[model samples]
Target: MALEYSDNMPHDEDDASDASSDVTELDANDFPDHFSEREGRLFHSHGSLPYPLPVDSPEQARLNNLHRILRDIVELHYLGPVAEVLCDVRGRQKRVLDLCTGTGSWPMDMARLFPGVKIYGLDIVPIATRRPERHVQFEIHDVTRRSRWNDGAMDFVHARSIDLAVTDYPKLLQEAARLLRPGGLFFSGEIGRYVDFAHGFSSDPAHQAPRAQRFFQVVNHSLQLRHLAPIADKIPSFIQLSRQFTVPTIQTFHIPIGDWHPNTVMRRIGKMYLNALKDFAESLKPMLRETGMTQHDIDNYVNGFIHDIEHVRGLVGVYHTAWARKL
Candidate 1:
């Protein structure tokens, strides 16, 4: 979150005396962003995107790390056939919508790669960046409710890590359908809420992460209280049942949790993913408090989860990405 660029304009030597007259100097430690702090972490103060995580620099770094890992694994900004859809066949720039655009990395990347594509990032708070590149715009809105945007207004829609924020996943899909023109594309990717092991791994003494499991169990309970639950697996069914999309594709990638993977590259990926998860566990502390857990209990669970993810080489998680084209 270091200042992207100096906000104050430079003045000539003669005008140095007048610099402080009109321009207020910003303190080195000054954070202009407003947020609600909990457990020493800053969370978004408003909007319908009730994602229970910090909106500060550390959380943003974690999100960006996860984004980089996903991109490195898939080696692409998206999984579906979107390049053709993004082509300007209508004699106008193609429209792209991103839901819960955390860190706004994906849309920004798309904007840079496809200058002709219009990328709209929707979120409750604008934590992405102060300056947006051309063809990239950010919108503040509630994802739990229908958006004010018109029907069939986009050529493509993208959503990631929205399982916790959006209460009704199926309804969101229906909303995506409403906003996508005929033959438009929709894509979503989510990391599993709970940890799972790689093949031939189990909860036995040799491979179990008991504390980690308990932490996620608590998380599941917490989510239920908030009218949200991990529904990454139901994404395909939701898309199919809608009957508004065709050729729906579903894929799951195994993400290693630590540096235990035998493959050199995977080990690197695992270490990076684990580093990101450590930050993620910290961000969940405030929300976990609402589950009636004592401060000591929250600290213990979070610390344990971090330790397990860092030390348990067999620890793994699943990333599910689903995409389809509007019929």
Candidate 2:
């Protein structure tokens, strides 16, 4: 449930074709060299790329304190500690599949927290390293496919922000159910949609949040992928549909990307996100110039909204985390 893994990528055209292919047998040559790089700052492993993005980036490697804090919050809110979650398990060693393990943060943390567990992160890209204390493996496999994972084999199956890789929620859920051992846990955290600024936050003057909000709406509509929806709101219903698993306990919380209130943790996050957006706008200026907006217009639009949020607060995004045991 950390920010890094919770944010789903926009689905690309190539995703469908890639998902349809046999992922397990994919060769290293099929992907970029960096994706299959076996050595780095962290120890290397035979990890594969299961998704469409390059996993090895400076932005990914430099995880900040807030990321760790968010991870801890999700861990506490959902599964508690690894020992406590696994204590009820029937086995001495647990096999876990970290579905869509972006940057491998969750699996890495899991391995560090529970050395006895065998954790494997399956993604479109290799984002993790080998750990000495734990049998952690990173593989590039499209978990969206039906034949991807062994049925009833994993003690725990965890997926976060994997919606971009999966077009069908039911199929993904079914796959999760099938992969888990009897009575094993199925843990998921996802966002259904971005928050509507007008409903959630007051209008901002200096940082044209109003315009940015409108812009985001247009962008959201234009984008082919729409997994950013408020996924937490639907968890209860999704769990009810799973006959193989018991009703899942759901927890939803506002993860403010920047400081919304003057003194709130969200305000800081809001600023960071605002800056990130600004940086993104600058990067895309060349492509967006044809849209008729001047560079200043883009800057004002990006900065105005962020400044307004920092000063006025109120708008916040929701993240969901849930867990259910296989019956």
Candidate 3:
């Protein structure tokens, strides 16, 4: 089934306002200041790449929403209604692990959808809310290190948007393979890179409005400096090279980065993406500064990027999902 979009649908401003207003302030007593000593923009306690983002209320809200948006895009375009196929294949008493599970929304939702499955969500920090679901558990663990789970303990090992967290992509895959039972599935989804805009306004890529090229250039540079894998573009090949898994299959989806699409669903998704990107760029300020990008220059780039996204059309980002079974 193809995903459909409608342009003439009614706008739900009330829902938008509710979502915007629902952000809860992080209580210091409850959340504890885990990042009190971090001087950089990225979280560094994990001894990995400095996670270039704050875990404050607003940032948490943005991440939660981005998680939902990405999940919707993947489910609609890639997995569709067949996410439960893994559950059926592995039987009802399934164990699932989600690495880099920011906000833990995906695993929680999966736990609800597959009530018989036990889902474990791991990340560098515990950002997931306490949910009533008994089968879903969230843990604070880094994916680059050895996991506490025993060998062949998982039925499905899932990862998403972990490009920034991993220093060794192949090693992480090896760990995942070790954790999965034979014939178990390993699935990953990631954005290949920043959005690529196709607009009629400019012929030069450098001169294009809402130019995000520089933003990503700084990001890539920082990741390279930190010796992190730029997994966005290299994820598929990494999966193919792993001897523990069968040949991987992939699905791709192009998400608009602005309200440029004629279809209402695409436009809505694009607008949400624009907001998410704005927050994402803001989070990169510290890393960009570390790269010696002046605050003035970064500000100019961010402003231009926002302008392009708001006024321009034809901007899109590619998201890819690759999956294979343990041999």
Measured by TM-score, the strongest candidate is 1
Which of 2 and 3 is ahead in TM-score?
3
Q: Flag the better candidate by TM-score, 1 or 2.
A: 1
Assess candidate 1 and give its TM-score to the true structure.
Answer: 0.85
The window of 10 residues in a row where model 1 has the poorest summed lDDT is 14-23
**Which residue runs of candidate 3 sit more than 4 Å off their true CA positions?**
1-33, 37-44, 47-49, 76-85, 88-92, 198-210
Write one digit per residue (lDDT tens) for candidate 2, span 1-327.
Answer: 111111132333212222221123224453443333322322123233122222335335432333454564453523623355455345345677788665677777667667766776775544444332335666555676753445666778887766445555667788888877777888777654454343445545224446546545533442333332324467657777868788788877665545544655555655655454444333334323434567786566656544544554466555677778888
TM-score of each: 0.85, 0.66, 0.82
Q: Which portions of model 2 show Cα errors greater than 4 Å?
A: 1-69, 75-85, 88-92, 130-133, 147-149, 196-208, 225-232, 260-311
Better of 1 and 3 by lDDT: 1
All candidates in order of lDDT, best leading: 1, 3, 2
Residue 162, model 3, lDDT:
81
Root-mean-square deviation (CA) per prediction: 8.2, 9.5, 11.1
